[model samples]
Target: MTNFVTKESLFELQSITNPVLAPNEQEALFIRTQMNEKENNYNAHLFHIELASGHLTQWTFGNERISSPAWSPNGKLVAFLVKRGEKQQLYLLNSRGGEAQELTTLPNGVNSFLWSPCGEKIWLTTSVKEGLAITDEEEKEDKKFPKAYVVDKMKYKADSLGLLPQNRHAQIAVVELSSKEVTAYTDAPYSHSLQGISHDGKTLVVAVNRVDNTDDVFRTPLYLVDVDTKEEIMLIEEDGYYGDAAFSFDDRYIAFGGSDQTFKNATHGHVYIYDTQSKNRQKLTEMFDVPVGDYAVGDTQQAASAPTVMWTENNDLYFQVSTEGDVRLYYATLEGAIYPASPENEHVYGYAIFKNGNRALMTVSNPTFPGELFDFDITTGERKQLTTFNAEFLANTTLSTPEAIVYPTKDGFTVHGWIMKPANYIAGEKYPLIVEVHGGPHTLYANTFFHEMQLLAAQGYGVLYVNPRGSHGYSQSFVDAVRGDYGGGDYEDIMAGLDYALANYDWIDEARLGLTGGSYGGFMTNWAVGHTTRFKAAVTQRSISNWISFNGVSDIGYYFTEWQMLADMNNVEKLWHHSPLKYAANVETPLLILHSERDFRCPIEQAEQLYITLKRMGKEVAFVRFPESDHNLSRTGIPSLRVERLAQITGWFIKYL
Candidate 1:
């Protein structure tokens, strides 16, 4: 029986992420996540694989969901994080086999941890009180009394963490493995993130956002602390959100990744090397055009942090880059030589490279595959698939492969996109087409498998997804081009791509065009319908409609509007000019507004305002509000809700398009 992807098929899909290469390079550890259909929950377990023997072992069990596995330098023990009771804690187990032992019992719980180079100690991050704070019991009593929270800090509240703790700030601490002794390096009024330790274990690097008024500028400075003296020195003084620092094997140089906030959140990250001997810094990837990350946004898997700089024996850097919708590995030398180390059309979500750099363990996926660990030999350019967690499920499923496309936009610049025809596609058969725009306007729609696209194709719809001018993985000018211009260039790029597809591909039905997107893509969808009537129907998820209300509503709206649009309340005219709601009177297409109630990035109100206006005008529009969901509802929200959201999207297009 040949079964195609569906909303229910999401339950059968498994994701292999966070591949960690052991120090010996003989084995690898990774997280294999699967959805529990009956429970409607996700369960992640630690899995180990021998690179040479191809043998796999499930190391954890009982649905405790583990992540961030770190192997000791000696390769004898593995440390992983898991939520126990109410807090995330660290546990360690011997490689030979044994029950994991609780390592740390910090009051604030562990946020992130890294093993020291010598393997004798561990550096961890935890939030602690910054000032004289009331006890938890007292705080609860105060809440019972209904006292108002006096607002002081301009940048107080956040999305995921909810209301910011009045007194707590993330601090760094080091724990000795042998004696179980803990030492606090930072306390009070400052939050610190442990980057990495030096080879000799004498210095530990940390990143701190010490700006007095964070609302003014985005700045994260790097600091090197002497382990023995407990003295900190600001290294990498000129920076914007710099971290992920790693010392070379010989401790000659420290390499890290960051950007100068040229475009704020839309800025491309670059890798740099700081010479400890000469006390000077040099940019190794100044010429590399692509951003150093797997910045392609997707709902199927958790967004993996960008791979940090990995050092080779000869001081070459093995890092990841988002280029043309694929997150591939690239090797860069100090002398300005850079080239791809991974093969084409494969997305390396996360990777761990050995000090020798000749071998690496990475989680690789593509349009036809979910994801799996691969033992890669950099010098020989070979890869051996190490895990088959989803082989059985995928073997029974029919998938669609996308065709790479390059179409000219109206402005003379080129746009890159991918098109997936209906399953069992036939020549000269006109099929309904669905155009997908990605979020992050800065994020890429990459060569990775997307569940929604596959599901739509299963229903006999051709899906067209593209990286417009605002998307990453392109030239800086191309990404920044969307900023300030907003609907001008990016809108034309999308419309031009659609025009090219309809003109070039005979299998696409020009009369049955549909549009759907989430976040920034949602914004574009709203803009598309108001500007053009080509799309018969459009589905917008977590979209922004009215910039006037969005600036005050969204968590990042105030700064994001100013940074991305170059407009604020002061420039209401420009803001309104770019707002889709400003042109709501022109909309005629049936619109499906999907949003989460708790989406702080693109709040549900954005949907409400658009939905209400369309309804008042007697236009065709429907709104669906997901309960207890956040901005990441599509990606990491409730399993049942995710299925429902997909069903609604597929149903909307099927009923209209």
Candidate 2:
């Protein structure tokens, strides 16, 4: 182990996520994940923690992929999803102690699971394909014959899932824990996800979008279904995203997260409360400026699932909010009053709010730390670190903590960013600067642990990353500003951020500058090198070069282009006008293109086109292609490949800068 961060530091990192607070309030269960270098894979296990003494205990072992752990109401038994076979199946274990028993045998793997209030049964979401066999034992012939995949739906393909199976829909199932028998509930053509259930277990809320065209965004309609009578009631009639739902303990209120698409993808998800008896819904947090949940983008976490929008025992709803550069816990009442419950300037990626609502078990991380569990007293705003999973990483690494920076954009708006000096920094020594941009255009760069940024800093470079216009964690207008102006103001904001950093800090080398980003950030990196020669070198990862071809090739291109550009193929002129390929000839910086072979978000063809075009022009460009990786190659791809990706980026910058 070395003091400075290296490729090996990624393997030493451990992430604790998906916290399930036990019913007794004295203990909690969470998934602890670590990158195992020996096997070159990720290993996940169920871990239990005593809240009072902060004693953590591992419940499961091996290289198993465990997820969605739910504790029974009595805290006597715990259930989770694990994949010991072809698909993930439900498994139950005693909370006190016991081997987990496999509980479900379904045609498709379970997507999500939730324990009913009574704990008599477990409701789950699993795929149901018409022509598929009922068990994994019956699918041997399909592997041998390999039938052709039918593509009749416009939304058939996705980034990670690839082309979806034909006639397959996410349906519901229930496992009778005592008898170990599973029952197929209502079969739906569309997806029917189990969101939350009432205390009485007589009703369940499910996430389902019964729309004609799947291309439309924010058309989700949650349904409150009667479990016994099979009756359905539409929770929200408006076309919006109301997926994350939870029923109050008394069944008096149902709270959910949604937005009416008033600002398209930029709209902040608001919290809503539906009165079960009155049949009236109240929109809370309507004036809240930030979105709900942890939208911070980073690679140091694994299996980090968002907590369902839930209610406290006092009927106050609690949720996480992405604001500025942090994700903090916040609770809102049915009266619409909201208040922060956790500390500021950290990423609360996962947490379990206690029934009393005054305490919580949070997985917190900062720039220097991977995620770890902490017992947080919400009312008192006190927190005690409960896990030392990354103790080795903490002791061995000399990481550079980011200094928050704010500067005015070309326009009137002020931009937020950070500057991390080199790990071995001297007061007067000028170092090379690398301006890193985040993708999503809708996602913001939070003040959480970023492995690549740390790697760059450790390599003797000042890493400056910014949340330019169109990045979330800001105002809706700021995020929507770059919708049609890809390279217009957004690009200017990035440059202005660079200019501010250089002007304000004397330790940064003015001439030796590098640029980098992925996805939208990758597109920007390409755009920056093409439009200006300010940077001596640049690296573009999982980028978009030509929007025209991207409109058809990318998994989400068809609707995404229209969503981001506000136009389609009919506006080829506009697409080309904003594409980085249009200005590739002007590129003078030696650029390194890194793309995943199986990436469907931007697709590998985009990188191929750029690399080929740059090679044809005899430009100083090199392309590194990673196999079996999608758009998340840098984050959750193969561990060896992730290491290689870091090496390529740092090596390129070291060579040119």
Candidate 3:
């Protein structure tokens, strides 16, 4: 009998995002994305969900996708981004809903946009063209540039479109809605673009990263621009990479999140607040240490760097903090008062503050639930479930809640982990155990809901996940312990965690152990199999095997490998010594390599290298590649493919373990 999970069952529920409360606070405008299995694409449209009537209306229509809907201060109009082919232009529509009028027709497209206080104009950041001059003599002299030498010296490289002309830098632009006039605000040789506009509309901030490379952390700077004259002043110098700056309502201060510099095994994110007039900046939450395991599960390279900050009407600034190995919401007063909101929630992904200041809408999930919308009241400190995406389906399915476990590492560090007992588990029956590792080698896997883990538990197998060394959510030193010792301390941490489970959990069968992970987790999975024969089966996704080849192929290859491994291609011998591929001959477990064809993050080549090497060594291995998918196949890919990927993973383990 074929046990298959279909797209309909996976995405029958709607996913909502970017919830903006109407000025009246009676309704909210949000983006509802539904999967179109026939087209194998997502259909995203604007929606207005009413609080009283429970009525929902589709606000935007047509083939183009509309997102990032921001309600005008006057509540008369809505400004959002509309995608037409490769171009993403800003458009305005009446709140009552009608035809959208195009506001700006930019060359490359807008990354982010915000409406001015008066709503007469919209400020946005877009990629702009910069011409290059080439000298015939210089072109002929250089072997690398035999033809016409074209120079585009910009801070950031333009994201490529199929055949469209590329622009290296992004600049801030202002578009007057009534006049339909567009003006370039700050156009620099190196790309500088706007990030957020203050409530007063006097100050505009932009995040400008290094143009030619991806080591943005070291080169990106946040600059302040005058909205009227477009004169730009460097607020945060082009130093360590930083982005996501949100201004307080009074424009008295600014809060931004990022790191000071990229270091080996360094994955901590710092949130800083600056006084506009005093120009004084203080880093907040330095006391709350971030664990390396948390970074391993979180989006370490990009998402972790781009933290969201918002100011409440009460003068308290709210931001996201991934402390204690869990991502949660926290609020800080302008006077340096800090407190956590909803600290009890296991995992809260996305959130939006309501206009009325009474409540906020958040996307919350735990070990059992997938993702559900919740209404959280600020004044009452109460949370109410608003929407259940898969309640009905889940009621009929057997799911197990993951139990949080604390285990001692070999080095005397107490590691945290979660274990899911098999569904309908018999009291004395032993079950196979799956050790799932998270990516980022810096992210965290908390006691939160994971559909894949639930599905494995539903299949009568125990699933175990731990915060090993190099993972985040512990102390900074503990997080940095795995740096330069990738396969050493981190390997010991996982083994120690596993040993704890084997010794404590009676239902876990040690002989039937399996392993799986993606990206950095994939790398660890590969590393784990090479180091031990305890795992009966293994599945690695978007993993890195050979650090030398990875250093040159991946988009983040140069910096990530250099920083994490504490070496570059010049240290080829050291890179190879630490790589899992070096010990491919020791593998006895049947392994499956899953990757995306267009995954620029880890690159599919990483999987191919491991597959070929394992097969050559007479080991059982299979390679699965997803077409047209990026590194975020599980979280952001087509619903159909995501379900299939999970099913394939389950099948692989069942067949072998």
Candidate 4:
């Protein structure tokens, strides 16, 4: 017997990330992040394990967050990032036994870094603002004065990064370990991210948007720069999109992820290998149907990096792919033979291969489990559970396992999704159902643990979540279907999925149906209520209601509006027609609108518009505003507030459904 998972289970969950194999191949280092309920914050620290003995140990202690822990070439030292100052600074620790010491002292701090092949120097990626010094200068307290932010570019602000500092770019810098001297590498007035450092550390591959006025477009190409000469050469010609580059041990070939933008952002990503000598590239997974990276979306998984191509001594490259609501590890040979590397039925969010060539450490998670580290044998398919971060919680909580299902849509499309019954489900008892739609319209709801969904299940509500036409883990045509159509076919796909569930599952009460989602899903929830009277209640989180206003107010409004809606200020008629606000008068279902005050992605204004319209018409509608939260409030918001937010949702459904 197990206890029902409550909203407070948020603190019980712990996530593991960035597992790197030690040089000796007998140990692995990783970052473990968990919540501190009393402080309503989170604490992250470095942790390592002796792979052979399965002994776990924590390296750092504090009420602070830690990330990106890496081992030196000889495994005698460790370097990690922490925010002890105004910005995150690099910290180094000696494996020979010494307290961690702060390494780089940049005023703007570091974005990311790569360990040199010889471990003698480290490559630093940092943010640089023009008309400013790189070194820390004595701060002269400025006289209190009012200032106004001014911008001439379309990319003036981002969702999480907030307003972009004028003339600032992500640039590359180098640090000499012996001298502790820092050298600025690229100063092209464009953002540059260190992709791969050559085996000899003489050549570096960096991804940057060097084109003029790229603020209106999204594109980054890789370029090779000589360490000493500062000579740069473009790696890909006619680049649509490419990155995640890594050089082979012999520097013979470079493997990376690329997309020709066949369908723009909806294009399927593929793996490619470029010959350093020939300067020619080969599309290794050109025939693969899915995207090249882990496109799986979940609330529990945090800071999972974009998919990358990892090269081994052999002609093999390892990568992860999202397919049919599952993210798994797959490897492809130079000859283009792709096969599964890790186990099936679980999400491998992170992995590190040992130099010994026989084993790998995998960070795996699924619906029943929060996440943990696992030791996997590549050749024999043998595996061992390495970490039990969520074992006690698992044993204590009665979590619901989702049952996968596929139903036919009105347009002859097969929609894939999962149905989770209540945790304390009773046989032959009818339960109110809540239809969960995912955001992104591009990202996927895969086989991963989600605290919010489990909370709904534990509250005795059957949950239905499906990947409609606009979701990832499907074909390019499927993912691209929602483009320019908005509430058209994608809306039909969701309603049809719900109808199929009602017809197949007698345990779900049709009369007491409810609907909810965030971001894109929130938009769908708003659309569903306005168009149909089937749902008795609905909750929209950080959602969009008016496309016309969203296209101008959102952070990505400048380009994303045209890319998805295929309409800009020039076509206000089309934008308004697709907006859920246009159908607000027809809404009969009681609605709850949840939004973040600081959300620039969808903007809180969207929620305000819908709330005002419904309230003016004397309709059953309510709005809840989350303070000090962005678009990610549900996942990475204040721990106490996250619980309160869930209480609002379950409470709303309980009152109406």
List TM-score per model, in order.
0.96, 0.97, 0.88, 0.97
For residues 525-624, write the lDDT of model 3, one tens digit per residue: 9999998899999999988899989887776677777778888888999899988899899998899999988787788888888999899888999989
* CA error at residue 421 for candidate 3, angstroms: 1.9
Query: For each candidate, what is the lDDT?
Result: 0.85, 0.86, 0.72, 0.85
Q: What tens-digit string does per-residue lDDT give for candidate 4 at 1-657?
A: 788988888888888888888878888888888888877788888897998899998999988778888888888889888976358988899876679988888878888999988898788888877655556453453569646787777777788768877677788887887787888877778889988888887888888877767775557877888888978888875447887678887898988887876676777888888898897888888888888788777878666553387777775778888888888888778887899787656788998776544677888889888888889899998999989888899988888999999988777778999999998899999999999999988988888888888999999999999999988878877999899998999999988888889999999999999999999999999998989999999999999999999987999876778888988989999999999999999999999999989998999999999999999999999999998889999888888888889999999999998
- Worst 10-residue lDDT window, candidate 4: 132-141
For candidate 4, list the clashing residue pairs, or say none.
none
**lDDT (tens digit, per residue) of candidate 1 on 387-429:** 8877976888888899999987767677999999998688878
For candidate 3, the per-residue lDDT at 530 reads 90
Residue 347, model 3: lDDT of 65
Model 4: CA > 4 A from native: 138-143, 237-239, 356-358
TM-score-superior candidate, 1 or 3: 1
Tens-digit per-residue lDDT, 1-657, candidate 2: 559998888888888899888877888889988888888878889999888888878999987789888889898999899976458988999988989888887767778888877888888888877544333333444566777876666676888778867666787888788897777786657777887888888888877877545865557678899998889998876866676778888888888887776777777777888998899988888888878777799989997987657778898878989888888889888887888887777899988888888888889998888878888888787888888888877887898999998888757888988999999999989999999999998998997999989989999999999898898887778878999999999999999988889899999998999999999999999999999999999999999999999999998898889989988999899999999999989999999999998888899999999999998999999999998899998888889999999989989998999
| Angstrom error at residue 84, model 1 | 4.2
